[model samples]
Target chain A: MLEALLRLPPGPVDLTALDPAATPGLDGGGKTEGKAALAALGDPLADLQERLFAEGRADVGHGRAVLLVLQGMDTSGKGGVLRHTVGLVDPQGVRITSFKAPTDEEREHDFLWRVRRALPEQGYLGVFDRSHYEDVLIARVRALAPVEEIEQRYDEINAFEAEVLGAGTTIVKCMLHISADAQRERLQARLDKPEKHWKFNPGDIDERARWSEYRQAYEIALERTNTEVAPWHVIPSDRKWYRNLAVGTILHDTLARMAPQWPLADFDVEEQKRRLREEVPVR
Target chain B: MLEALLRLPPGPVDLTALDPAATPGLDGGGKTEGKAALAALGDPLADLQERLFAEGRADVGHGRAVLLVLQGMDTSGKGGVLRHTVGLVDPQGVRITSFKAPTDEEREHDFLWRVRRALPEQGYLGVFDRSHYEDVLIARVRALAPVEEIEQRYDEINAFEAEVLGAGTTIVKCMLHISADAQRERLQARLDKPEKHWKFNPGDIDERARWSEYRQAYEIALERTNTEVAPWHVIPSDRKWYRNLAVGTILHDTLARMAPQWPLADFDVEEQKRRLREEVPVR
Candidate 1:
């Protein structure tokens, strides 16, 4: 239910249409109920993750993987989703990459270089805190790249994703949708708390002032890069619990559908058992 | 209390001397009690880890980090400790590396070369599933390397750790000590279960048969390489719950001692607050 509701549809994505405060697919409206629902999903999420990892370890049926790409304006709770949602799985089975502004070395190559290098191996869940979409979103909003270069990235991203899909990597891109009001409150909270002061940046005000421009950039990026295979999920962000629940539900649904089967042993099981018990009996 | 009980002393070590089923430092007996104690430590563990991470992110003081290295024979519950103990922290701040049999490329370089690359950055908790100590353990037992070369590794390892210590990385090494009978049952359980069959390698039986040699190798490795800076702790691993609790307590204690402070804001707080409220007043 959350999967179908949160997964962005084709043709156009307008920021003005969707309410960031709306809880679309969640069963209960209250915070306590929403959190309990998420906690309940933990065991099953862990089970599927272990199966996926077991498949990789034993070279099971499909050499497939999942990539979760998170794109959000500052303080949209990307870290919260990562901590509360993805934390349900065994960390060994998950590969997380946080993309900062490119270093000189990263900038020398095409934007996708670092991203491609960080792709998860088969049977691992790969997460991108911020991904190559930055090339379009921030690059367009700030004019950080040439106009033509920025223009070229949409199709380039699609093509790159197509190649990844062909290689059996399922891409789940989520645009953490937050209201300007939500951002203001969160930024203020950061300012208010001394412990959270490290998270606050003075430049955030400069960006916060240009909220509409960044929102427009996201709409463009969403419209251009959204694909049927790798649909974008617009998670409402005013409520942290709901956002986490929605993303967790979507991921849970995706993995359940994938339903990785445990691989059959390559060696003779009966013979190994005999050898384990008798031939190499306990000393 | 747990740290003192588990920390190996400055002398020759004997595996037969420590009872694998013994639950020292834990107040209550049984699996339920041990698991409860570990669960209680989760919040404090999470808190300390975040502070450590904050220090790294903001370039806070000292720039120190922690590395937990696990060295164990087959079925000593290394995976359990990782899932139950290290899993207590945020996965984002934890860097875990499982060192398998070195590749041909890894062989071309010195063993420590790969170890050096996998070292945790400042303020992160790095866990090695199997580590450089593998070069000493299996390499010595299986005669995979030369006698003279293995003899030199102890001194070389000490020098290498001294350098790592100088750079502010605290090394905590644990040898998950399980009895031969415990390993037999663990191996038998894997053989008995189909879902776990993927984890069973026939070669494990061959290794199991040579249990005494491996124990002797571990003892030598512990004696020769153990230093004041990075002593080896042998956790009795027959009871998986007790093992997890002990390792968790040791890690919680280590991080608490480090007491990483939340980084102070590097910018002007009052001015940012003003700019945040006045210049960009929620549009």
Candidate 2:
């Protein structure tokens, strides 16, 4: 139910319509309950991931894998979601890449080239801290690309997602939606604490100054690129616990639907058992 | 005390002398106590890792990092140590690499080429499931390389590690020591459980048959390459709890010694605070 509520609604993507403070469809009444529910999802979530990993390693049924793309404005709890939600699964089964501003070499290729290289191999739950969507969001807001090129990235991204799906990877694209007011409090908190100092950037204030532009950019990017093949989910992230729970639940349900079976032994099981019982002793 | 005891001692590396089930110098007396002690390490371990990560991010003090190398026979629980011990830290700050047999492309280059590429950046903890020592271990045991070449690799590996230390990574090399008997039980357990079938390899039988040779190779490799800069720790791994606890303690203490400071804010905090409170508000 929460997963359905989180999906980017079927029309123009409107940020103002969603309340960052609202925890619609959440099972719990408050943060304490929400966190407990999140903890509850861990064991089952870890089991599902193990099954999926087993399926990938077996190379069974198209070698299915899941990629969860996390996109959010500054201080919208993307790192928190990664630390809490993705952390539940075995780190061996998960690959996390936090994309920063591109280097000169990365800029030499097509926008998707570096992304293609970073695609999670078979049997992994891949997470992107910020993803290719930045091309449309930051690229548009900052006019880093010409209008036509920026317009073209949406179709390119959809086609890319289709290709990723065709390769048997499920993409869960999430935009952590936070209000400007929430952003202010988070930034203020960072400035107030000495330990949080490393996270603060003066440029963040510059971006905050152009908040409305970034909001419009995100809306247009989501609206144009959101597709049935790989739908975008706008997660209200002002509540860190709710954000993590929503993402974890969606991922858990996705793996369950996959229903990866225990791969039958490629080796002769009885023979291996016999060897273990009788033969495998030399040293 | 355990850290000092576990260190590959000053003379020849002697696998036969170590007890696979021994919880040598473990502060906790038994499994129940060990498990609780390891669990208690969660907060302190997590804090130390965050500091190391912060230092790396700050690019201060030589941009230091820690690399934990895990080496073991099959069924020796390399994956277990990763999941239970390394998993204690934030996944974002930990990079885990599980290396298998090198491909033809990898073989074309020097052995440490792929390894050098996999080193963790400053501000991250790196774990290698199996590492360059495999060049000497299996390569010598199976005669995959000429005897002279395998002998040369020991020197090359030592020099490679010294260079890595010079470049700011503190390497923690651990050999998960499990007896042949322990290996057989683990293999048998895999054969017994259908869910674990994916892990069993018939070829493991082949390797087990050559167990004595592999053990000798490990001794030689460890003897030649053990150095003051990056010494090997032999983790008696028959008991998974002790193995995890030992590895966790070594890594935890290593981080504590690093004592990475929370970096000073690069920008003016007061200026950013004033701006957050007053100026950066439009949308």
Candidate 3:
């Protein structure tokens, strides 16, 4: 199904073992050379992305909003994907919102409170760094809330996404898939660097310890929340280059489907000239 | 002075024009070759931007938040300039907030209330589409409140922006300058397209009729609010490509000046490999 949906060449990472029911195994162990695919993307990916962005910008005339949801574990290349993907789109029509740990007030309301307010306006794109999936993932992993409450969030998130989709928002959820080894290396890198010291939290190691648990949480979240309107794509992120290419490709495909229109339907040189004439006052 | 500024080969669109006492004609005549620069950026630009983004991504470190305020008339190309300028930065580190007419609750509070909540986190870029300046501009133009109250708002805005900058946020304010004829064409384009129908507001025409008042209000705003820390750039909007290039160049230059550092003090493959072997558990 994934191969048919994507026209780009398949990435080198083996996904045959990407079973939601079972845990992901060793990095680069299944049957593919991840390094080769990353190198293959080359320079064309960027050009393709810009073209897609320009098309999306013009298409805002269609009065539809595109909401891109980026969810991944720590150091899973969410930042990389966002930086590259949004680089192509016009900044005027795009808004990127990052949802961090809930503030005191945020904890007081439903998990979706902060997210709902960040929805994109008609004819714009809204990118969420870490979405409401936290209500299921983090809350469940940390045992921050009761089990029933955590499970119920999946249904609530689905309904919430459905409502937004019905209201002219196209939601594209991407789950960045990274290897345990890669994440540990990244986390260690964060600790090693003085500037990155602020990013390294001891709790992250604790979360790393609960790797299996988090995986289960992610599986449940994707399986329950992934639907017709807001489908989740599991992008292999061990290769930052591949992660960027996959995201750019997905966004390009989706925007192509939406097909935003240009501001002017019919170019009228006479009208433009007339307007210009009126504008230049005889000073 | 305008010629000298423009001759700098599309550098940061330094907002010196905002000084009411410094230069008078600058509000309408500032040159914007930003879009041309963007197109000219070519492969080198892409390569640099990708490297910059990668550099930005590797550290996972945050930097001072730069808030760009764009305030102008309906057809002033505020959207166009924003789209082009932000296109040059790392989206993961940027946030754009478009402030429109306040909601009922917003009206009850001081004009800067909603804006305060949307302040970007440190090391991120926050671009205000139409910001607190509206309290002074729209309130004065639309006669939403009294003259004394409106006059007080100018200082309030200046002070507010200064505080944000003082709190480690870099504020860049831009006002798009469009000829009367250009606006008419843009409005007509909106009206001409079925998809764009919603964006075309008859009220904008009425506001355009009071062009003199808006111009005067904007003049006073530029005079009183442009400060050392949070300056405003008046960008020429006659040519969309030029505007994009000009704004994009300014932003690119601004980020370059910031020179966001990677948290890593140095690269150590041996240490990384050692840490992985010792700390990382095998599945």
Best by TM-score: 2
Candidates in order, interface RMSD in Å: 1.7, 1.4, 6.7
**TM-score per model (chain B):** 0.98, 0.97, 0.79
State the TM-score, rounded to 2 decimals, of chain A in model 1. 0.97
lDDT of 1 by residue, A105-198 (tens): 9999999999999998888899999999999988999999999999999999999999998998888898899998888889889888988987
Ranking 2 against 3 by DockQ, winner: 2
* Residue runs of model 1 more than 4 Å from their true location after superposition: A280-283, B281-283
TM-score of 3: 0.73
Which regions in candidate 3 have their CA more than 4 angstroms from the true location? A1-16, A19-64, A184-203, A256-283, B1-63, B181-206, B236-274
Candidates ranked by lDDT, best first?
2, 1, 3
DockQ-better candidate, 1 vs 2: 2
Give the per-residue lDDT of model 1 (tens digit) for B188-224: 8998888998788999999988888898899999988
Please write out the lDDT profile of model 2 over residues A1-283, one tens digit for every residue.
7888888876797799899878989644899989999999999999888878887777774768899999999999988988999999899888888888998999999999989988888888999989999999899999999999999999999999999999989999999999888888899898989998888889999998889899999999888888998998988888888899999988988888888787888888998777777784466
Alpha carbon lDDT of residue A27, candidate 2?
A: 47
lDDT of 3 by residue, B104-199 (tens): 998889877899998976666678888888888878878999989988887888788778877767676667776666777777777655555545
User: Over the stretch A171-263, how does candidate 3's per-residue lDDT look in tens digits?
Assistant: 888888887878887887776656565455556666777787788788777777767667778877776755665666667667667655444
TM-score of chain A of each: 0.97, 0.98, 0.79
Error of 1 at A76 (Å): 0.7
CAPRI quality level assigned to candidate 1 from its DockQ score: medium
Error of 2 at B147 (Å): 2.0
Scored by DockQ, the top model is 2
Taking the candidates in order, what DockQ does each have?
0.64, 0.76, 0.24
